[model samples]
Target: MRIILIGFMGVGKTVVGKSLAKNLSIKFIDMDNEIEKRENKIISDIFKESGEEYFRKLENDLLKELVKQDNIIISTGGGIITKQENIDILKQERKVVFLDANVWTIQKNVSKEINKRPLLKQSENIAETIDNLLKKRINKYNDTYNIKIDINDKNINEVVSEILVHIG
Candidate 1:
């Protein structure tokens, strides 16, 4: 079984995916981390040096490679849904789980790790940025998910458990 976790950054895709992979006894592949490994640079640096378009193209190429494996759980980047091609590649034979978090929840979660997120790097108003970005990607998320799990106010353990129950 291949499961792909999709959502905005700081929505606990990495955390939940790790736990879920352990629970399911599958290998866990963090897309962003693999990208950094392959590119020899952090995601923020990729965005800074190469630009979003280049990073997105790289991410899509990597996603195509990652999805072909079996018995793995993938934690995808937040903006992966920006391109329909990414969505199509992700949904080919994987269960795409949308770890839904509202704008306010996203702000709260992202504020703690704002330094790591390239998109929110210079936003003075993180809440507004998250809200606006969510508005742009919400439809894309809705369009390609196999299941949706609202993770607002939920801890990482709880989120993993919820995904397990939903997927099973």
Candidate 2:
């Protein structure tokens, strides 16, 4: 089985995806980490050097590659759905899960690691930025995921359990 987790940044997609993969005894792949590994640079550096358009193209290509494999859980970058190609790919998957979290939850979750995120670094006000981005992407997220899991105020295990129930 291939499980894909999608959401805005700081929504615990990576955390929940790892736990879900472990519970199901499958390999877990974080798309950002994979892209960094392949590019030989951190995502922020990729953004700085090559720009976001370059990074999104890489992301779309990687998503195409990853979807062909089996028994893996893919935790995608927050903005992966921004591309029409990516949304089309995600819509074809059976277990694409949208892990939804509110603006306050996202801000609190990502406060410590703001430097690691390229998009957040560009924001003058993180909360407002998050809100605006979420507003733009929420409809795409709704259209792409077959299942939606609310991650607000939930532990990783709780989220994983909820995902298991939905995917089982």
Candidate 3:
């Protein structure tokens, strides 16, 4: 069973995914980390050097390759659902869960560590960018996910339990 978690950055996909994978005894893979390893560059560096379009293409390709694996819990990049083809490919192979958290929750979690995210570099208008990006992709996220999980105010254990219930 391949379980894919998709959501905006700082929604705890990686943190929750790691816990869920350990509980389920499955391999955990973060797509962004995989891309960085493959390119031998950090994601921020890749976006800076090659442009977002190029980085997105790399992400799309990696997504395609990752769906072929078994018993894996994959945490996808926030913008992975921007492309319809990527959504289609993920749905074909695995059950996708959207980790639904409000924009404020996301902003609060990510604000201190904005530099880690290549997409949120500008300090002055970070909130605006996050809002715009979330707005633009929410429809795709809604359409693509098999299960929608609201993680606001929820602890990791609760989120993992919710996911396991949905999967069953």
Cα error, residue 107 of model 3, in Å, equals 0.9
Return the lDDT, model 1, position 147: 87
Candidate 2 global TM-score:
0.98
- Lowest summed lDDT across 10 adjacent residues in model 2 is found at 13-22
lDDT (tens digit, per residue) of candidate 1 on 1-168: 999999998888998999999998999999999999999999999999999999999889989888878999999999999988998886675489999998888888777778899989899888888888989999999988988999998998888887778778
* Alpha-carbon local distance difference test for all models: 0.89, 0.95, 0.90
| Model 3 misplaced stretches (Cα beyond 4 Å) | none
TM-score computed on alpha carbons, candidate 1: 0.96
Full ranking by TM-score: 2, 1, 3
Residue 38, model 1, lDDT: 91
- Per lDDT, the best of the predicted structures is 2
Per-candidate clash tally:
0, 0, 0
lDDT of candidate 2 over 83-157, digit per residue (tens): 999999998899999999999999999999999999889889999999999999999999999999998999998
Best by TM-score: 2
